[model samples]
Target: MSDPAARLGLGLAAIARPAYITSGRSGDLGDERGVGTLRARTRELLDAGYAAGIRYLDVARSYGRAEEFLAGWLADHPEVDDVEIGSKWGYRYVGGWRMDAATHEIKDHSLQAFTEQYALTHELIGDRLAVYHVHSATVDTGVLDDARVHRAMAHLRDEGIRVGISTSGPAQGDAVRRALEVRVDGEPLFTSFQSTWNPLEPSAGPALAEAADAGARVIVKEVFANGRLAPGGGDGTDGARAAADLAERAGVPLDRLAVAAALARPWARRVLLGPVSVAQLASNVAGAELVLPSGVDDELAALAEPPERYWATRSARSWS
Candidate 1:
């Protein structure tokens, strides 16, 4: 029988590379990397990813000109219309490219934010954009409760762009469940959900599974726990050890193992590979092809912690 990890999906359009996920890591943010070098490296990575079969690219308005960077890349590759572009709204980039800015992004989930970000995204990406998600939707954000925002998202759907939400904080499961219920004209308004789901914070898995069962596409973000799940990090010492053992058994690096663990979930349509460099991307690509042995998922699930503890650690991570 074919390997389950080899299954294809609409999100990334490839099976052997964490769906070959792409994001704006090369953009300015907490990264102190030089702008000239960052831009050039981002462009090179885009070309390399495309050549390596990565179709889905994730960006956001808050990702420090990430949309602009992606726009520039797309302009040079007009022949690559089949690439799936997904971006998040609701947060504005306030860093002004400052590496040490007091605040890098500011979140506002009101309909006004959605309207403005949508227009900007449209202007930058044109027709190649596939999905637009609300950045970091939470229980206190009131975005799920905002009828005006729902209506605006419905209008975007009418315009042929898929709408969704990316959940953050301890209430991510609640966020996804609520997003699934958003409706327009008696139909679901949203059709996708992005959530954090590493071994350390698998609490969101049940909601994501429900989302998949409801026919909504589910994308797994922070599959590495924001680099904690990588080879070396300061968070979750015990869980890191467990991941290392799993990687050793699987004959892959810790980063690849972490990604493969995310892909092992049946509900995952795509796993975002947030590599900051070309070398890291190459390592993460191995995850798409490395299927974990039986029982690994259960073992990883055992490491799951309460949502509060999991999110608290993530909140403390420095942008660097």
Candidate 2:
């Protein structure tokens, strides 16, 4: 039972890059070249994470060779039991490793697949994994009531492993929320859900609220709006402006204010900011140390209302 509050800056402490989880297919990310150096890189990143107070790490089979690299680091590493790992299943890969060329895709959420996948990854990342999130359809598709998906995930939880789904967007969030409301197995079958919550596409609001009200864990990805929230090209300019006004009133920076606004959501457990550098990671973690004053926080909240339109017609979202 790791401290949830500590896990607050807790989960997915911004990953240091050229470890882009968003890109693949062209780059030899998991090839011999990448694998040779990845473990050391991960160790460096983990050291930085510890310094920054991040206790949870999220990885998946498809995230290049991330898990295998981590597996190497945590094997006899002193930090083995210090952090939490939340990995996923569903997308089958070639070889046991994610780097190999695709033999085929299982694409099935069967209980057998889930259990087997979990065992495969679990065998690699045991004490490191504190949670298991089914990685649902993420490539321009949505998750439905796939019974196999449900049963396999439930199987994981029944074994005492915390199970959940890291949904893609509003569509999946809607499904997950519905499942929770109905209490599939006398209670919400899943303990957590990962989705979007950014100024660009704030569509996660309704479902997020529902899950929160139900006391389900709401882990957010793309909180920085895929780095658009940073002050550049005025990408999140409108959101940033609204955030700035909120920050001014609250006496905080836009980034800190933005993440704090997310924390304001009673159900949001953590915001994942997968940064590409140590500097970027620091900015995100610094957000948690900030406690906005009431007057300022209130002002920031109001500013979010008027300019919601600016971010609407935008595309080319970044989930990294």
Task: Tell me the number of clashing residue pairs for each predicted model.
Answer: 1, 4
lDDT (10s digit) by residue, model 1, range 1-320: 15432332212111111111122233312334555655676776677666656767888887766777788888887798777789989888776655457776789998888888989999998888889999999878898989988998998898889899998888888999988888898989889898888898988889999999999998888887766677654254676677777777766788877878888888998887666566766777777887777887787788787889877766765544
Best by lDDT: 1
Poorly placed runs, candidate 1 (over 4 Å): 1-32, 234-236
Worst 10 residues of 1 by lDDT: 12-21
Compared with the true structure, model 2 gives a TM-score of: 0.72
How would you encode candidate 2's per-residue C-alpha lDDT over 44-144 as one tens digit per residue?
Answer: 66666667767767777655556776777677576546676788776664433333333323465556666777887888887557688777644243333
- Which regions of candidate 2 deviate over 4 angstroms? 1-39, 91-116, 136-144, 181-187, 233-253, 293-320
Candidate 1 lDDT score at position 174: 90
Residue pairs clashing, model 2: 7-10, 246-300, 249-296, 250-296
Candidate with top TM-score is: 1
TM-score of every prediction relative to native: 0.89, 0.72
